[model samples]
Target: MREVDHIEQLVGKLLLLVTPLEDRRLHTDLHNFTHQLSCDRISYSAAALFHIDRSLLTSCIAAIAISIYLVILVEFGLPSLTTSVNNAYGVPNLSEISSYFVCIVMNMYFFVIYLFDIDSTLQGPQKTHTLLSLSLWTGLMVLRLVILAYSSEMVVQEASRTQRLVTKLQMLPVPASSGCQEELLLFEEQLARSPLHYSAAGFFALDLSLLKSFVAAVTTYLVILVQFQIPDTNKE
Candidate 1:
């Protein structure tokens, strides 16, 4: 379908922007990165039943019900009678166990909420477009968040290693302390300029938030489109 094609094109462009590649090495490394993020966004959007355009919410209730049932089943399993014997000594109640399970389920539910909200915001007035811009936006945000988390972990590890190296250098019996001072100064300058030394978490979060706002603007446009649809018969 033309609509499908358009949607695909849009998604491809958005993905390219999210993880732009210049060199072959970086391109190869990031190949799976965009794909994974896209998949996650699609999965989350599907779960929310937001793929349907202009369809009544009730139309997807059955699918939503099945999904909820599956969630419940995974959250709570059958209790073993043999375990009841251990319960005689002391065992957690089903309610307590279910409560913890419900908490996890609720968190998952919120994640789904966040994904849908982000998606709806991104997808503006393009009923002819089937690919779902909101979904793509959600994917980008999630990818950015993941990158921030990973970068933070790397920063922590590198800082610890640098600290250990400095400690070792201090302990070394240097005959000419001047050489050591120069080496330390050079190292400090390198650290200041190094991308690895910079904390990207704040920038990452800010970028994601801006993406969300952009999506929201698109979503508003889409809402207006839906409100003023052209009459099919044009009888009036």
Candidate 2:
């Protein structure tokens, strides 16, 4: 919610800080778009995969860091090629080296994706810009599933327990005229109608635990892949 507030402030500044001396038509269009934007809360989702919230940026960067780890594993951990084909060429096979380089390059590229994903909040009029934003949005959403998972049911259970505890506290003895009781009641009422979480197509809720699960899953699979490949490479 605070992130949304910062986005509103940014839109406000862009609209208010424009100069009349600049390209007049572009400025007018920007003002109009920014005005429309300021009036509503914008939500970005990627086809039920994940939300385009600030946390997503962090998750993406972490995933890229994991990929970098994979690249290092491939470079130093995997045995080198030992095929007769290499002897014929009299040149060291550079495919693994090239792939490691590509991974490094792509890690930087993913950061660019993260930047543009954040930029999507500041939407514009161009169709191309919108398409680019959605593309990045989709990519990240898919990444969320590929790199993470969590039991939404666990989160829902904990939240329900916490809410119950809070409501029960309101029953505690307190000064009759104290504002604390009134504030607690108001808070309870406000939360009563709202579900305690956000889910993906009703399948499960999203939370930080999901990111942890994703990292763990990726690591396990990578280790298995390396273990299986080592024997095959040894035989070769």
Candidate 3:
């Protein structure tokens, strides 16, 4: 989000720097403005943005670990553990009870990838609250991811908006100096040639569709692990 804000500010500065008409009669300072925008601030911004904390690579690693751990624990661990417990004592199998605990941990994880898995929550009649809580936390994670993507998306939106404004300015029927026209044309070309995007290094674009990809990856791995698990009867 901070990166998005910074890029928008740079683009905004560019737009402001280029949009003014230079009238020699009025003794305007238009000439120096372009140099400041193109040299000092833009160079600094490019240096800062070139390595955005390794961008989404860090995010993908953490998200994959959390998602895979939670799904596998919920789908496989609880049921297997439940059958191992001695239910003859009239105690609720730990399967459902464990899921409740996962729910509790999930709440913490959202505020902090400090999250966890479940088995006790699936612990029979108590499963509802725990299951709902897990779902809610997962939903919150989805929301957080979407917000980040949307924030980055604003850079593109702002760039497009700036381009439109520049084009419209160029089409005006009034007489314009060559410098002003050249500035607009240069900025337009830059915008076209260097479109803004967010991604995991260069693997995939960081958009709403990223959520679907994450889910698909987790599900695929879970299935692969389950398929390769050794059955107790077969082991004998």
Candidate 4:
């Protein structure tokens, strides 16, 4: 994808910019310089990782904002015929729809970045701990994506079912108001008890809790990226 290429190029440029001396040097200088470059690269790589992770957070925030907008539209504006029909079928407000969309997009973004990070780690020299951390993070992200997808699908299915029930109610010669009310309440309770709902909530909580880990990982990656020169131990 274009976005992936762009990010790779940006990271490459950043590493190049931060790299130290390139000229061939005495053995001592080379050794010391190599060590310095490695240290610096680690820091730079960590910073770059932080930036990328922040982007994900920003995406989440954007989705939340859209959901809020939808809620406002549904609650306060002049009700359109389409909205009325949707409401009759128990279609969720704009916020719920927006939330689902945002979750899907974010999940995809996380997947891409996880792959990129894994590839980078594989292609370059990385410590055992770094590799392990990246692997765990990637796994967690994948799990989150799966959970999000499942949750969104469940919500959509529930919405469809509610719509059908409402339509059937509308067709009755004498409206079964009491029955409809009881059915709606049961539906709401079922939704609350759904595994998908719990999974979504858990993933959301996990992601929020991971902010600190994300920051640390990005910091480590940046450090690895920027420092390139080999160092000399004898000179020291």
Candidate 5:
């Protein structure tokens, strides 16, 4: 990524000013920097994952951000087409539970970050934006992302279970004379070759892993944003 290269150059210059360093040292120094570059590129590729239509991912992100900053900070929940997890017959989705669990973690993250005195740095008139308002807005945003991600992930999980069943059937001892063997083999092979995972135009899989990466990206950026917003003196 362009930003990655720029950061590497900046770091190299800083190191050079401290002491003389070899070219090899510079090349090997920032392993995590290179890793971050790879992650950034992959995240950019998966940005448009929530929608398949021809809409900009940046616009989608901006909508969520606007909801948090303008709407939820003043109000609470934004109206959207969300499902109530069916509390039926001692059963529902484990994915929904996963989302709920992560939502709790995000809730903790908000409170933990605010322990740095975010409220005291208030710009007078902006004093209305209390800790509760900020946390509520951010927690809602986290819920929005986690809920949708896990819901979409259900499709991929079902397909995997079906594939595993097919695999088990194929592995069973069957007659060599039966014509069904060839069909089972073909189906199993096809499933293996193409694998039934949903994606936004084949960019990446819309599974639980996507949820993991999505949350990670949001958390990382949120930390960076908060760090910049709070002044050094306040942080002290």
Candidate 6:
């Protein structure tokens, strides 16, 4: 609860910082004098794909989860973990799929920005710097979450594999294998004692709750795959 409160406080501070940038005419003279550019009606965008604003933060979060979902589908297969859907699934060309999907997703985001006139709200020279700051902060947060998610997943997998290996080792009939079994037991104990985690610049550590959120995101991705009707094929 205290962690949540801390995050809330941080967000409140960021909102306070963004308040000044929201005013399009706030830094007009400064921008013109320093940047030799017009501060009036200046638009903000990222690589010409989508405008930079609060909506961008939401778009980025969605994009990250979608990207993760697509990766899982291509690498781990949908509806099952054992199957690989890369070559045996929809979209004839496996190599170009990612590029094509990225293009489509970007355009979709562009359409959303246009449909809602989000860019019009951010007109001003200072808006660019504001957007950049927000983008940087959001990117860092996303990186932290991704690292924590994957790290936790790896730890879980490793623990399960080690447990299985130890179970198998203990069933061995040969007494010479006793030493190997003991070593496996010790390793398992170590794993149990110190679980894996990820941190952001020594600020905070990711834990089980973050892992749950990551899993939920992955689940949402699966739903997206189903909605898109990801091609499933049999190569054999």
Overall lDDT per candidate, in order of appearance: 0.43, 0.52, 0.50, 0.43, 0.53, 0.47
- Give the TM-score of each candidate: 0.24, 0.25, 0.41, 0.24, 0.39, 0.29
Clashing pairs in 2: 147-214, 148-214
TM-score (C-alpha, index-matched) for candidate 5: 0.39
Question: What residue runs in model 3 are displaced by over 4 Å at the alpha carbon?
Answer: 1-122, 225-236
Query: In candidate 2, residue 5 scores what lDDT?
Result: 72
What tens digits encode model 4's per-residue C-alpha lDDT throughout 65-126? 64454444334432353244344433332344235344433443433444455323234345
- lDDT string for model 5 (198-225, tens) is 4433444445686677667657866765
Per-residue error (Å), model 5, residue 231: 3.6
Query: Which window of ten consecutive residues has the lowest lDDT sum in model 4?
Result: 226-235
After TM-score superposition, the amount by which residue 22's alpha carbon in candidate 1 deviates from its true location, in angstroms, is 73
Residue 151 accuracy (lDDT) in model 5: 64
TM-score of candidate 4 versus the correct structure, residues matched by position:
0.24
Which candidate wins on TM-score?
3
- Pick the winner on TM-score between candidates 2 and 6: 6
lDDT score, candidate 2: 0.52
Per residue, candidate 6 scores C-alpha lDDT tens digits across 1-236 of 34544555555555455545675454453333433322233457766657767776786575466456545543344224322222243243222323433443444333333334444445466555555555565455456555644665576577567667756856654233224444445545544544333333333333456546544554565456444432331221
Error of 3 at 195 (Å): 1.3
Candidate 6 segments whose C-alpha is farther than 4 A from its true place:
1-121, 176-236
The Cα error of candidate 3 at residue 57, in Å, is 52
Clashing pairs in 1: 119-134, 121-215
Off by over 4 Å in 5: 1-116, 119-130, 171-179, 201-204, 232-236
| Candidate 1 structure quality by residue, lDDT tens digits, 1-236 | 34544665665665565544355655554555556554654322344535434343554554355445434432332123223323442223233323433443333333343344432433444521333444454455446544644554565467558745755665554324225534444444443444232222222222234335434554565554433432421333
Residue 126, candidate 4: how far off, in angstroms? 6.7
Candidate with best lDDT:
5
